[model samples]
Target chain A: MNQARRGRPRDAQVDERVLRTAAGLLLERGYNGLSIDEVAERAGVAKTTLYRRWPTKDHLAVAVVARLQDDDGIDDTGDIRRDLTDYMEKIADALNRMRSAGRTAGRDDRSAGVVAELVAAGARHDDIGEMGRQVYARRNALALGLIERARLRGELRADLDAAVLLDQLAGALYYRVLVTGAPVDRAYAERLVAAALDGAMNRKEIPPCP
Target chain B: MNQARRGRPRDAQVDERVLRTAAGLLLERGYNGLSIDEVAERAGVAKTTLYRRWPTKDHLAVAVVARLQDDDGIDDTGDIRRDLTDYMEKIADALNRMRSAGRTAGRDDRSAGVVAELVAAGARHDDIGEMGRQVYARRNALALGLIERARLRGELRADLDAAVLLDQLAGALYYRVLVTGAPVDRAYAERLVAAALDGAMNRKEIPPCP
Candidate 1:
């Protein structure tokens, strides 16, 4: 056990290097181009060391995404609409980045790229699916708290379902990217927030029809 | 051309049989289990004939889904909430059916199954992606028309963004099925529609703090 303890520091360093290399490769080459062999060669680590850590490329890819998503912290500035819109912008930025990753600059890149692959990977493997769900759960909890605060503060409706609100906001972005092949930018984010926050029912009285 | 047209009736029959057989297999076995060979054999058609209609299993699967979704006609009862809820229920039913397709009875089938596979297939192939977008376009046009009618009738806001509203309604359903692994049913659909149609902002007058 003591002998194994001696290698722990070196193991941590190797793990960082491998993950950095893997992230670069995944973003540069998309899911298909990310080869474990290439990652080991670039990271100056043995294949056994890489396998010992990540076990498989899918696991390694999931880790890279987890790291990439670490910076998406939600901020509650007491203005629920602005806060939610800003939050949606952050999500759109991450999704747009993932959507364009690992393709030639001039080539057609309308496809979902590595993002769709990671989603499919989650469906293909239970562990990956669980990890993806856990990631969403943590992020959603933060957003839900933000919504709850708004509701408590009388900013949002008392009967609002925070989870459903978040779902509508985030889900529209995902649906656009993954299904509709539509572009999601800050302007679109603003429109999405406005639509969700303001009810679509006619508030003004209409003139009687002839 | 006339001679080719002479085989048109038989070809249409074969197409129907292949699609029906493929849909059955897809529902029974999920995506991976719907083999082309098996579909051809079960349809009692030659392998080449099946191949001529659907070049690959993904193509066949897409055709099956397109057929499955052909009957999702939206109802215009003049009440936007009830109409949209009914529309959403239709979408949820289709998604729930796909989510549970090809799984053993009483088994845990939370995975996206065929839905995620079809999404991935769209990302993997351009033609499939086009077909998917076209299907959504047709369906969405109908829903948008319903929304437009409601807007004209003063049920919805005159300045409402119909596409955004529809996106929110449908996007939430897809997001739950594909990402959150949440159960989407009539009850959930009702809640979702209510959330979208009724704004989340607090409408009641807030009493001054003591």
Candidate 2:
């Protein structure tokens, strides 16, 4: 093993280089314009090396998004509201970045952009779909842990569904981008977190239970 | 106008026939297998007639989904919780139908199926994207009206952000289908609505608000 690895570059460094290069192409030219060959050439890596790592453009694109999600890790500050809002904003920022990919700087582009392409990529290929789900699962695990901590500390209801809470918070941002063609900014993220934390029912009056 | 309408079958009838036939093909063959030529042949309509209406396969697919959404209209029975839960269930059912399309029944299929393709179609074409947004806008209008009436009757908070609330309910379902690969069913829909309505806070104890 030592002899085989002696002359080779570090795998982590090579992966970072290729992923950064691929991400640039994906954002600059959009999904259709992101070519495997171009990413290899731009990253100054061998085509075989890139191909061995990512068999298709979809795999490479999914990897880039997975890394972006990884970078937007959860920060537990004990204040569930603020922490949740901050996490939502980070997610919103990442989504907004992808939403604006390949579009003009200031134009009101309602297109889902690379975000839709990645979702479709997950749909098209089984391995890519499994990989994407794994990334979300890991990210969600961290967020769920934060929620659980709050619940245990009496910050949240003992009966709170942590999965659904995370779903509502993150889902609103995605729903805006993919379904409503709406912009997701920090303000919107705050609103979403607030709505989810504080139920819509008027506390003074009995809720409509029928 | 009278001359242009000369006995070429009622426009509404032709539209209904075409959309129904197209939706069948889409669900049966999935997005990739849905062919305009086959739809024209199966629907017993001229290719020009279909083209004059939809223009492209993406347009036709979008129209099919729009019709499906319209058919799944809101049910406002004065009780916002039940109403929202029912609405979420409908949306979940529709998503599940599309999620299982063209796949073997009773298999553990985690794929998003045709739903993802339709979303990608919207991103690929501006007209499709606008059409989809209009469809959701009209549907959301009905839901917002329900929330407004509930608020007027003291069922909900006076200053509640109805848009954010709706986004939370509907977004969670879509987030499950598109991102998490989780099954969205009636029980889960009930849980989601319950959480959104009651919130995650332990009101007896002060929430962890900074």
Itemize residue pairs with steric clashes in candidate 2.
none
TM per model?
Answer: 0.91, 0.92
Model 1: residues with Cα > 4 Å off, grouped in runs? A1-13, A105-108, A204-210, B1-7, B105-108, B204-210
Write the residue-wise lDDT of candidate 1 on B31-109 in tens digits.
Answer: 9899999998998999988788788888889889998897678899999999999989999999988877876644355
Using DockQ as the measure, which candidate wins? 2
Query: How accurate is chain B of model 2, given as a TM-score from 0 to 1?
Result: 0.91
| B1-210 per-residue lDDT for model 2 (tens digits) | 263676655877888888899899888878888888899999999999888888999999999999988987787788998999998989999998898878774457888988999899999899999999999999999999999999999999999999999999999999999988999999999999998988888887334444
DockQ of candidate 1 relative to the true structure: 0.52
Q: Which residue segments of model 2 deviate by more than 4 Å?
A: A1-9, A105-107, A205-210, B1-9, B105-107, B205-210
Ten consecutive residues with minimal summed lDDT in candidate 1 chain A? A103-112
True lDDT of residue A17, candidate 1:
83
Query: DockQ scores for all the models shown?
Result: 0.52, 0.56
Q: Pick the candidate with the highest TM-score.
A: 2
